[model samples]
Target: MDLHVSRDFLRGGRSLLPRQWFEPMLLAVTAGALTAGGLSWLIGAHDVADLCWILGTVIAVVPSAIWVLSALRHGHAGVDLIAILALGGTLAVREYLAGALIAVMLASGRTLEAAAQRRASHDIRALLEHAPRSARLRKGDRIREVPLSEVAIGDSVVVGPGEIIPVDGRVTGPPALLDESVLTGESQQVERAEGERVRSGVVNAGGAFEVQATATEKDSTYAEIVRLARHVSAGSAPVVRLADRYAAWFLPLSVATAGLAWAASGSAVRAVAVLVVATPCPLLLAAPVAIVSGLSRASRYGVVISGGGALESLGHVRTLLLDKTDTLTCGRPRVLDVIAAPGQEPAEILRLAASLDQLSPHVLARALVDAAHARGLDLSMPSNVTKEPGLGVAGTVANQHLTVGRHNHGSPSPAWACAADNRAMLDSAAVVWLTVDGHLAGAVLLRDPLRKDAPRTLRRLRSAGIRRLVMLTGDREEPAREIATVLGIDDVHSNLTPADKVAAVHNESAGAVTVMVGDGVNDAPALAAADVGVAMGARGSTASSEAADIVLTTDRVDRLADAVTIAVRSRRIAAQSALSGMFMSLAAMAAALLGLLPPAPGALLQEASTS
Candidate 1:
């Protein structure tokens, strides 16, 4: 079952006595009782020791009784029921010291568990606290500081160097260099030119630049991230369910044993011993501790796990489905090959194509420009540049008309024939034809290369017990197949829309736990549908990150494998701690049932087992 904290629960006011206050109060009472009982015993004042223990037990029992009543009112049974009975049994037998000790154990275990949960929620708190709160509003030639809430859409804002972008906006001035690490978890600085969209929470790494706000602070990407985080934090972890399952069997056994002991020995003392020894402390403590430790390890490696349930699910994932672009490949297209026309130089053809592409905003245009710059080729701006949405771009460079786009469907001449043959060789590469003065000049082959560590990471995932590996991508069949072949993935689903991806994940998840890793806006639906959604947070779209159960803060794909390994190790450790404690408790319970152990010694044994 999907377990989540309802909105009403968060909106509901805190308890009358907060855990912070209650824990300290309970601890102080326990300490006082222990001190008084020891001093009174030394002086041979048995009545004073009994009174001190009774006072501590009363102070502790108040909260325990309240919790049990609350649980019963909600029509549910709680693990605290056993502890409450143990306290009552000890008091009925006049074993005040044993009751006081059991009270201390229960209070201390609850406090520690609560503290671990608070620690695990640090990432969510950090996300909320780090949001930008102000912006510099631009009024013609003057800039005025204003609260982010007052910043509206269409308002011009001037972001200064090292300042966070207060809202999502379009850059209006010179190209701005921004560090988007805070927003996207990418450490690299990205360059945004005029008319390019810039998200909130990214720091301005270069000179001050003007931007026209497209969204208000409350409606910005950072706000969306904060909302998603809150939702994730409210969700319950699977480990909690695992503990409850253990308790389902354990509680009945403990109660039955206590009743059997009472009937056999005809003494309430034997029953009290059984109850004291079977308090379920290990189930209450060990699982959360292991989960918190795993979270700490993930943070050190730049992975932000949303909750303990996500970590547990990731550890047992049987099928792994991943997006192709930006996940397995670099997601950045680059010039791989340049085939020149007969007697035409490759550099000349590239120079012409890059010059014409400078006026377009298409991804291919940026790839061409970057390629030209890397070659140190100086290019002049094209004149009368025009781009047709699905066709190609056209312009005039140095008094010669040029066009770059798909190959025209017609009989190919000798000059175009050579380029066609080169294109045939690269089925996986994106081909852009270069035409100069109405003649086919050459073809530029662009490809988004596979990540260097992808193959090794895939192998490691197999070693970690991921039985099935699949690729689900919106890219064409050729590139998708090419990437799958390189990575040794057995399954490939290409050219799928967002809905198709969701359907794919749902189908896979029906049979086994499925993990979907992606980094784009289109991947959000599929991410949510998977059993465990892992987002490459660095340079990923906000939609995907918000939808993901785990966010890899770094761009390294290998970290995914490492996270799974850590999760598996953590699960094993938690099981070991809990089972070992239970084993010891069972042994102690058997001794207590036979009259070899008394209530006080049984409580001590229970404490030792849990510790």
Candidate 2:
């Protein structure tokens, strides 16, 4: 609970100022009058034939009944109205305190509802305030602070030590290292050379590096996540058609049954008794309270579910369609394994690749560095380096012409075609062709590893009632199928464009609620198309967070199961609360119909019980 909401509770629930204060004081006064009337014969305070009790009762109870009806009715009658009519008319017959107490109880229920609602709104405000407002802008030899909106593409920016990069920029100069965990989830500070991309909102952890801007302000990934927060503020919920139908029937049935009891008994007291227990305040407050509590639990696990409706709908979701990149894997191309041409030592081939790649930022270059580090080799400095984009780098190590790159991205180093028998070994790694002293040496292969938690998360979702798990991606069939198999996913769709992804989301959602998870521009449309859109918060800076229904802050597939569990719990709580209130109301109606009580005394008993 927020401090501001607590203050409001003090002012509204305790003090009840302005018009609210008047009603409570008025009701208490009426209660006093009823007590006097009930004890009139003993007190001897009034003359015989006096009508003080009847007059006071009419004055106090009639308006209380009307106001109570107005508070609960939304253009239609409800069980609460029965309590009002029963007490108001009977109060005219000299029972005043009964009506007053009921009014007070009704107000108390409303106060509780108002405070809970404010607390939820305050939580959202606190979350949005965490986003940064200003960024450090860099222009050649001139460093200035500016609003994030002023940043533009193609401008060079200096990301200094201890400062956050404010816009997406491509590295134009080498640095010792950069901490990109905020954007890429890589544990180590990604050592940067030239021509590598860096996103805004990432912390600089090493020596200062100059980078040319690629995207800025609204176009940056951080800006997009903030936008996603805004869209999910209201939360997705169930269609109101069913709730409307329930409301229509409950009120009429309650009213008709109360009328019949009064007509059969020929006593206004029976009708009053029925009305005493008719109010649905308890049920009305129950559902929202449960939903809010459940949402708090979800926040602990890094999933921010927007509102009561979203939680309720999750109880019934059946199928799940997921986006592959960034959702299941690291989303960065890294070295997975290494292979050497026939008769070549794998260790020698990797050392040569790392030596030449020390100066590059191409996909293959990072893979070589990763491979060397895994083998406990230090990828320090080498001499006479000539690096080029779309071509390999040239360098001398041990008097050898060492080059590392793609036949396309890396310069064509001495080409060593693997003997036919050894070619099969290259398939497991993303082979980066390498050469040394103009002689074919070997190739280094790279791959983005699957998320450490993907398998476990998928299993939990299945246990939690998610029937089908589908993986959709722009990656080729083999990689997509490989990931699906690893994660125990049911269906795999590969080589999809953004438009095709949206179509797939709709297809999977047929007759079931679909949740689509992704972290790139290509996944935005599908996120919007699914019944529930979940963004992997850490890497989702690139995706349209605005389209997602829930944002997974920890950015893990495992949290999906946790999110579903929370939603189901919330719905269950709401249902239990609503039903409990309804059942209590019915019990009151049954007591009233038995002709054991009158409206005035019944209202007082019900009000006292509630308070």
Maximum-lDDT candidate: 1
Residue-level lDDT tens digits of model 2 in 57-138:
4554444454444434534334445445545644544444455445445445445544455465454554456455776666
Model 2 CA lDDT for position 258: 72
Per-residue lDDT for 532-606 in model 1, tens only? 898876556666888899887666898899899988887777677667666777888899899998998887777
Q: Residue 368 CA error for candidate 2 (Å)?
A: 14
lDDT of 1 at 325: 73
Clashes found in each candidate (C-alpha, N, C closer than 3 A): 0, 13
Candidate 1 stretches with Cα past 4 Å from truth are 1-14, 66-78, 149-162, 167-221, 234-236, 334-425, 430-446
Task: State how far residue 206 of model 2 sits from its true place (Å).
Answer: 12
Candidate 2 displacement at residue 222 in angstroms: 4.1
lDDT of each: 0.77, 0.62
